[model samples]
Target: MSQPPQPPQPPNEPPQGGFGAPQDPPPGGFGAPTPPPADPFAKQPPAAPSTPPAGGYGSPPPPPPAGGYGSPPPPPAGGFGAPQGPPPGQPPQNPAYGYPQAPPPGQPPTQPGYGFPQGPPGQPGMPPQQGYGYPTAPMHPQYAAPQPGGGKKFSTQMQIIVAAVVAVLLIVGGGIVYSSSSGDDGGKQDEAASAGTDGGEGKGGEGGGLADGTEKAPADTKSKVGFQLPHPKVTDTTVVDGSWVTDKAYVKTGVNEIVGYDLAKGTKLWSIPLAGQVCAASRHMSKDYRTAIAFQEGKPSAADKYPSCNQVGALDLATGKLLWSKSVTSASNGDEPVRFNEVTLSGSTVAAGGTSGGAAFNLANGAELWKPKTDTNNCYDMGYGGGDALAVVRKCGSYDEPQLTIQALNPATGAPLSSYNMPAGVEYASIVSTKPLVVAADVGDTAGDGSSISDFFSIDAATGKLIVRISADADKYAADCGSTEVEKCTSLAVGNNRIYVPTEEHEGGGEYGDTNEIVAFDLTTGKLVGGRADAGDRYTLTPLRMDGSNLIAYKRPPYDKGGQIVSIDGSTFKETVLMVNPDDESVREAETSFSTNYAEFIYEKGRLFISEQMVSEPSKSSSLDDKQFLVVSFSTV
Candidate 1:
């Protein structure tokens, strides 16, 4: 930042499209849904979604086949995401991936290239379907009910709010279905509603896979028949993060409220309103996994040059009652708001770090533990992994330290455990996976802005010694980031003591790219296990993780909606494509790189939860409106 002004992209990190990190721009978030703050349910949430004949919950219907949530609704006559005629000024819907970069054959690139993926216009003979393409505004929302006298009422006691979404529900006589629309230029909009019948006739399935090839969960898991929670309406930018503790879901329902719902019944178990804004990224849980710690970013102060009001609070995950709380301090880099950069816990010790510095507190009663010297030593970025081991980089672009030093700290005492020094010429380094102990570094060309990852290293989590380094013949980190795109810092994924890397030749034909396949290497040995091929010539796929023992990667469709979730066998690399995309193509497209995606997908306790972000950007702004949040859960049973 000091040498010379590089091309400045948006400085502020958008919500990791799904549940992501601020410094990283992967849609949902930076860190994958590994642990805390990643998935709303701390560890595991509820069962699979199901459609039972009035007997959906308590009795738990007969189990479904592979991929829990039942199959698609027979691929609707027009296929998924097929638009139903447009609203009566909007240009004739050009069924194509609306990416601004590679404009449809005849259309020009949208102004201000943000580098997001765009969809191609409809093919000559197929129904229009775009997955991960340019997010387009739906033209079918803002519903109203007739008034008793002369006008319709929106908030009157007489107004009955029956449906929160009415976009698409595959399977006519079974799942919920309705259409919605929004303003074209990003103005105020609403989701359409319909007078849907409560019950319908449809056979519950043994197969959990949808028609489009989304994965199916186990038979014992329940399939999602409908949405359980209300769309989260947030007034601020606080992300609606969730966690699972004791068979319940701890979800942030609003700016000031965090609610715990009984996953089995979707019933309100408890609700805890924070004293300050809950920073989802600062989320942590104790060694016993009973208490949940989230940083309460207090209101900002106007006096200081760099002001922030932040605190750390712990709550009983089960009861939602306050356990303890204490104020926190950080090391500052003036002119920027002091935000908590990282949070971790070891035993009963709680630690946090920021641009300012790092501090530790007792987890039980929220008393000061000690102020360790984390800010000095040429390190500013603190990351945690391997459950409790805290990793910090020596040179975090703070003072032009030539080489990068990697150090492991005893989170409880903030004492050094193990340390390694990376060679010079490294511009940036990030701990990609803690479980597998991998770090990704961006060693930029000294003379240009062109950047690509320089190497991949496996370090000893306990000893902090270098074990293996792969700088060639490996997948370079996928450098693409977006408001809704997955994997902000793409490069690697770790699952079951194995590391998965996608080849560098996958994408970049246009906004979105494809990967030939993901290559697996033994976690400790760094030996190649196997490489699986992509489904098709341009199937854009990114590995999410080795979900359980099965490697799960998302096959990003070319369009804005209708992407497929596929699972690959870790051993055989055999892939199974499941019809799991929850976005109906009518939701808000994640638009700009700074815009938020419509939904963040998280898998917990065998069930898949979709956290829907605002679909339409508020007019006059190109970012998330931060006024809406919705969590839809699915399972296979």
Candidate 2:
């Protein structure tokens, strides 16, 4: 279970006996990060022409065409047990214009066809979900850009089995190399339980094989047969957010509506109605991808009118079959503007509803397993704590000085297994991940005076126990959480026994040097890994994911100068720019803004899927931009 100790730093002056002193190492002991050394004056975009993102993370490639996760995880250990690279001679990636080589030809069909069929359990002969149309043209390809190069390849024998020290990941071995195929994709999902990290050099957990990241990546590349869908044109509503459920991408079409489209061959599968925006689908959730859950926003059903909204539903992600949908008994006013804050499932428990209140239900049938202990408290904001537990952040204490409480509940039965009462000064907190560890943030911890408590903490998921606390100013996990002290940064990926957080450290100033922007920390020690800064330096970058052995970053400047998407070598921490963004005035305006209209990026099947963005212009369904919701898929197959 004991990991090799962190290498000791060599003395500044090497011993005289050593053969000629080793050549000075680059920033990461190899090539330096991309974009050249950070230039403080007159910053311009990376010099390169690139096709605009048709869309949208792995650096190491996947066998699943270009996209990642083409196939399911190797079967779990016992009932649930555990959890790639290119070769030499062949180029690790395509060097032409940053576009990946055309993917192979095995991409799966997005759906059967353009027709919206009555999904799985729609009233037997029910009419196809009404008012949905399909796209008929081919958009641009979401090319897979070269992200980080493989750090160092490990032996094929090296596997990331469950370790005792909270999933102590031995990342150096070619065990986790850069995807020779996947390359830079967008976005990442939180890591689930696999390695152990509670005590000294903990080894493997031998936990269920749900998500140990040890399973072999797909061998077959996911080829994208020419496919594109027009942006959905709805006046009353807009596509807010969505998830890639297996082969199809489920997105919020409009008010209380969701539509699924095949990313492979541009097929319109099904369109289901929704009540509101509170929605959650098990996208990268290994075997849990079968179900999708969302809150029914808007006025309550005839059965319950006391609360303006009180309905939650779950459906089969692929089949469109209804798993279970229920309305809750609430004391809320019908006029309250609220939707289920969190919708998650653990084991057999399906939980949907808002932070105000929610319940865990039976996955087999629509049965309420249990509700939160108190209505005044928030619902399941705390995500699933690895297995059958769900973490919930609730408000307790006097309103003027409310206290934050986190509860780990039994997903099947709303019983509190453990609860952590956060310190008093913290009024509100949000949960980022429950696995690896319970990471929560007190977003309200911002004040001019240093006394203001902007704090972030990690806790033990199984028990209501606090692990470590850092200044929220130092590292606020939430990207958009309002904080002026630092440039906005988000923790993009969690893997290999570490959490990757990228920040530009942009605190209102043009005086910026190439300081380490991306931060990777040990999941257990919470210490900077490798005693080295990230490879994202010299350029303003947004950390995306750990592609293969590299760290992919999006060089989307807030302005319109056409930026580049680059990757940082994991081992060397060297940066390489892969794709470039167009700098035309139109492209700049659309991408530079902090508008809520920004497209949602999701990773599935090795491909990065980007949903349509909310545009500034009003509707004219005939316009390609408004009429259809755009879904672009990228890969490095």
Candidate 3:
């Protein structure tokens, strides 16, 4: 779930109470559902919102259909629960989830501004809603959990096992590409901080595209519901964080199984039962439709509810086969299989990292490539970021004064090609992109927004030298990285020799809502580029990933509209709408429910899939029958 809104307005902005300004929740909490509008088609059109003229590549959306968003789509099937269709000529009632209220008539909206409101004000004109807005406190790393109550002492061997397990938990979810070499570089370590005297002239690596290659845009961009998976009942919040798309199947992680569904019909294709819960899943998939995941060694028991995340494996996403599953003995930890916190794939190597150390395996057949070494300086490979290239964040020094070494490695040999030492006082650094060698970290904790990033370091991976350091004021850009997960950054895309990030949601040009835009920074000069894609009034645009060289972004809908997916040209920064969802009440409600902060969005081959990374029991305030989706797919075909 989203943490909460964060960051106060910049110093120059006026205090709250402007257009799209967050407002106090009505008598009930924001989660309170709002009734849908009646006769959606017959209802007279709302007065055009008084929005200031602005230049954006995307044209203002055409007026809503006079007959309502086409025919209300057929009622969703199976696990989607039977949502009643609207009566003929009547608009579907809004779902119980609240939506923003239109501004009081004739009141002018404030000019565009940045930052979030200070208190628990409802989203601009929005009513009580169940979920939160932005992040507040940092989220716990996947394995990092609080210690159990009533601490009991254990024997040395048991303590060692327990410590290794704790170390595993400290690992954040992985997406990092890690490449490691020997610990014998005193000279390279000293130059890490001061190395980049001038930004390199090179245009990073080939820009953003899928694991396979750029996807061709479909002929018809209009989308309709394909399928929806109902939430699985779980006693606790279960981690189900993996999803992959192949030609024949759309595979997803279940409680203890990997299930594949037919691309179009959503019919079950195949299922591979896992030994235990999935702990970490690599974002990278091989060209042959293979990917890696980390899971527990066994099922939860009363004695050990949270088992160690020790098993690492590769799966054939196309065939639903567990290609290989194995673990490694940590020479430094009493020969125990190193409990991994995260796992990632680079070329034929599957790399997993934890507190005890990091290990790499041959992706083809699970042969050991390298294992954690016994180091005297307390250095351990914390994690790696993989994709296009592999890089690792190695931690050394004492616990109180830790130092991090970033390395670009040879995927096959685990040999470092280049290394950069992070400056003093940076406890964590997240790899935003591997090939481009973009790293983000909040040096000295100044980012206050839990983004874990204040600056971005563009490095020449081939030379282990810095290219440019782009300072991202937390109050300006909406980009974020997992505080502990070295590769789990979002809200930005790296491609076309630049980094595209969304400007923080600010008061929009409209008289009622807020808006934002995606802007780029030159990877070579750390300077803003001229290209920008505006989200228009009341809409917010977030970079999802790169579509080959172009950028794919999701445009969040206003309270009364359906969401849209747009493709932004890499060089021109012009946007082309890929999919525009239906504005039917039930459909819009379902689409809006998945907050960009916590859900996973995958748009490929004319299909968009949104799934929750984790699921927990509904709050008491939520109705037992309140509909929840595990995975929801929309397709233009």
Candidate 4:
């Protein structure tokens, strides 16, 4: 019913507080307390259909002014509606480009390419992604704090670890380089060290590098030629002419015996026989080579103790005829036994020493020249010093404290020229050489001590002045020879300017044993020269003669099986072994025995006359009884 028009709702009434209530401002004003604000920008409702207003309302309120409509006032200049400045207390935004907001505190900053999922509240940004879909893992608990100082400290620690690792690698690399370099030179260093040790010259003229220096080759290059044992044809059995001439020829002493043979063809030249126990002929061919000195031990058929007799008989060189005969007797007494050890002839004078106690002789008349008194009953050795002068040695006392006196006597008048006293308790005394000077060796006592001492003296033959004296330790001279006892040093031999002394091995307080050695010493200076001559058991040194350039030595092998005639170069002291027994092999025995196997050697006219006595007998019997003498000859080319 439209009776009275409903009065229009007052413009300023309070808004109802219920569902679908019209939302309008209260009449009080904008300052009054208000409900929460609704979303202003929400979608607007659909427009309503056009309707005419009442006559009075139809006039619709005059249109509101443009500025009077309820609209937000124009935003203040440079506020939200316009290009405004940054908010208070915030940095200005970059005009060039825009980037995501920085992550909240304690979170990693965002990266452009990293796709991060939405994170929980408080985390404004997403978790960072890793390469190959791997999520960004959090730092270890040890590094959870995001301290700026801690980051710098961690960087320093990393640098130190990296530097340390690099240093260690460099050290290892240096070691490898050094080892390689050293290994490359190791062989050359060893070779150089070895070369310095060995001398330069080797055997056979080759070069050997020894520690010392190179040894020069010998000046004389001739090889040594060995001696040959003569094959003698036994035609007559009772032949006693086994004596060898110094000229390498033999003279027979029995009837129907071959006297001489062509050494090259073994042809018999002459035959003769004579009665004698010992015989010696001269080597001088222009002189009387047929003149032989014979010593008959006893009367041929008498048991009567006749004194030993010696005869110097002359014979024709072409025919076997006695030219003259002379007899010599010991002046002491008829009962005084006479033993002849050696007979020497100088020019025309003949001299001989007897085992009974004297030296007497004459070459032409066989008259008693002079007899010297020797205290010892045995005259071990005698030799002519020069001219008619004779040197004699005799054992005076016991073996422990033996007295050895060397006396020089005139053979023509029996006048004592000089005498020298040797050391006491000497086992042996030998006159080694008589030339510009006389060399002698007196071996002293060797008992409980480990070594033996030898006193070497050089005395003037004319004045008997002690020119030189030297003492040598026997053990130091020979290694295998134990020189601790009295040894029979009869093996002493002398050369032109040298003396060779033999030393044998012996145990302390034991009997003299037999390991043999030959040591050479300078005659003038007494200095040791060449290497030692080791003949094993075959060490017997006999001085033959001194030629122009060489010294001859006849060395008997050990055990006396045979011997060799060696020629030593006087200048160089090199030896050449000229003779050796073909059947003799090295043998050892426990007993002391004399070797009857004689290599009778003599040097004259630049030739060596060697008589090798070959005896075939059982070892039980005496080798002297069944002796056979064969003569051979040799010469240097």
Model 3 TM-score, 2 decimals: 0.69
TM-score of each: 0.54, 0.52, 0.69, 0.44
Among these predicted structures, which one has the highest TM-score? 3
* Candidate 4 per-residue C-alpha lDDT over 1-637 given as tens digits, one digit per residue, 9 for 90 to 100: 0011111221332111001111111111112222221212111232553764332321212212334211122323432112336789999774211212444466664442222233336643433222373222223344243476654233322322222223222222111100001233211111000000100111222211111222222233222222333224432111122344423344433322325654333345565544443333322232555343435443334453222444444454455455455555455557544444334544455555433343555555555566665444433333333322355555566545556666665656756677666666655454444454443452545322322334567766677676656555544332111121111122344555566554333111111113333445655555555444333332444445454445555554333233444554554544555444322221111001112112334544334444432222223432323222244444432
Worst 10 residues of 1 by lDDT: 157-166
Candidate closer to the true structure by lDDT (higher is better), 3 or 4? 3
Clash number for candidate 3: 20
For lDDT, the strongest prediction is: 3
What candidate 2 gets wrong by more than 4 Å, as runs, is 1-231, 236-239, 247-255, 275-288, 297-308, 331-339, 353-355, 375-389, 447-453, 472-478, 481-491, 505-516, 531-540, 543-598, 612-630
Q: In candidate 3, what are the lDDT values of residues 1-637, reduced to their tens digit? A: 1233321322432111100111111121123355543221112245775773342323222222333211111213321112345779999665322111122357532211122111125322211122363212222232233457733443332322223222222111110111111343311111000000110111112222222336554555568888888777877657787898898898889888899999888899999999998878898999999999998888877877766778999998877899999888777777777777778998898999877667999988999898655578988888899988899988899878989889998888888899999988898888889988999998888888877878889999999998878777787788988766777787899998888888777544333555667778778877666546767766788999997788889887765667777777876665667777776666766676676766788988778888777776666676544677778888977
lDDT of 3: 0.67
Off by over 4 Å in 4: 1-259, 279-294, 297-325, 334-339, 373-389, 394-403, 426-428, 436-455, 471-493, 501-519, 530-545, 552-567, 574-598, 602-637
Give the local distance difference test score of model 1: 0.43
lDDT of each: 0.43, 0.40, 0.67, 0.37
lDDT, candidate 2, 1-637, per-residue tens: 0111121221331111100111111121111122222223114445543643232211112112222221223322321112222356765653222111222356422221222232235332222222343211221122122237734332111211111001111121011111111222221222221111110111122211113222122333222323434344333222243455464554434335556666554466777766553323432232644554554445334664322334556666666555666666533524443344345666677765444455667766777777655444433232333233466666665657776677776666767777788887765454545564444454454533222224446677677677656443333222332121110113355555555655433321112223224555554554444422222222344555556556655544433244344445554444444444444443333333222113455443344454443322333433322122254444422
Error of 4 at 396 (Å): 6.4
> How well does candidate 1 match the true structure in TM-score terms?
0.54
Among all windows of ten consecutive residues in candidate 4, which has the lowest summed lDDT?
Answer: 190-199
